[model samples]
Target: MGKRGGSSTKGWAQEPIGALRVGTVGPIADFDPDSTPGFDGDRRLGEELLTERGEVLAGLQELLFANGRAGDHRSVLLVLQGMDTAGKGGIVRHVGGLLDPQGLSVKGFGKPSPEELSHDFLWRIRKALPPAGRIGIFDRSHYEDVLPVRVHSLVPQSEWEARYDIINRFEHELVDTGTTIVKCALVVSKDEQKTRLAERLDRPDKYWKYNPGDLDERAYWDDYREAYQAIFDRCDSDASPWYMIPANRKWFSRLAICELLIDALSGLDLHWPAAEFDVDAEKKRLAALPD
Candidate 1:
């Protein structure tokens, strides 16, 4: 799991991915969703995953720095899409703390602005796209156009269904550029969400995190589940696959996010660029002149 889960010496990849099942919580799985390193009630290598994640994150920093200096066009689009109380902001904050802010940008989307609604769904999203040699993160994204828009009948069923193909082609185009997309759906159980909401109510500082209408939305959890299943089924691809991150454990979710990012970043040919001028020789000449 070192530097992006690039090498799984512990055979983590050989084990199944558990904790969150596809078609129920997050994405479309080719094999059984019940399989993973944490399956059968065994949670081995949790700390090890954290260790690997940290290493990978360090490597990403190094790689990003090198890319910036080398002027290589590389981009990472981290789309964190999830329901309320899923720790999307928390995860983004934790991971973002690790990176150089000059090269990073994070945008959280809410109800459309008058300007945002002026264009189609992807139009507002396109404005936030990370340029080359930088990382851009979206806390909530265009996927909302599919989720809530379809969930509450904000749009026609036919209209929302048509977005699958549109979104796929859009992502395809993103890959056609140099952008690598990390699509993570953070998930917390209903009970956990309720507990978090209670904690928020009790703590004055945490009050900002809660929304009263969330109670109403919580009733439609089953509908959102179906919506996610459909989205995962239609959109998971080699160009941009989905990661069903378990948000029940914040540490693990952050670790997995870093692991996946590291995995993808390590794939590029990242090398320290050759010195433009002979700095060593220049230093020697200056020293000699001073003497």
Candidate 2:
């Protein structure tokens, strides 16, 4: 059998995360998801990407840990968006797995529940914000406030249209408070999506995910595309911008994300706090504890 696909080579190691920028996608050929090829049921193309992802993730952890020690804490809010089968959950599962669970939190936003709907769009989101020194991830994120709800006419065009400014201010506040916001939208082709849908249908365990409703949604592809374009156009600010990730190949997507996130966090002024206890007092305290 052909080797399971993801590359583990150092050549494919993550680029400096700072190298990525919104409105600056260097080459569709270079970063397109189709470049990644999977083997069997696995997106084996993530092999090298996963390795790089792991390293960068470790780097993020180190920074957070140092911040924790120094009491000069920083927080990160990572937002993920993509069409269905774009690997949002998988990225969370694998990329997030590298983090200390205590320091990482994940939230997946679906349609607004009654309670969530009752409140303003950003209300439910604020509740999930990470405290200082931790990482918080939003799987579908508040961007949907501007995208699907607007595209599908799920809400008033006037209400959803106003959210761009609201989102920009909300994220700017996070950045102002020493929180870094990393946002990405995973992109995939209709053909690739169909293949994945076939896999879901063929597998018994995945049957629950087979939504005929998705076909109806697929008909609105152009609307979703326009919505995403508007999302990037308006909400892509200096404080927080959207990174459009090609997701045909899961490998490139993972590495791209790892690089972007790690880059954002690499050089923050992180450190361990100086210890204040007197040596003798600490020694005595330890001595008194359990002889």
lDDT of 2: 0.73
Tens digits of per-residue lDDT for model 2, 202-280:
9999999788887787888888888887787787766786777778877667766776666566545444445667889
Candidate 1 local lDDT, 1-291, one digit each (tens): 223336344534432222232433434323222233232222446555656556566667567666766776778888898778878988778777667787787888898999888889999899889867777889989899888888899889989999999999999988887788878887677777888889999999999988899888998888887787777888877678776776666766666676667656766656666788899998988989955
RMSD of each predicted structure: 3.9, 6.3
TM-scores of the candidates in the order shown: 0.84, 0.84
Q: Return the lDDT, model 1, position 63.
A: 71
lDDT values, one for every candidate? 0.72, 0.73
Candidate 1 error regions (>4 Å): 1-52, 278-291
Q: Which stretches of candidate 2 lie over 4 Å from their true place?
A: 1-20, 26-31, 35-46, 52-56, 287-291
lDDT of 1: 0.72
**Worst ten-residue run, lDDT, model 1?**
32-41
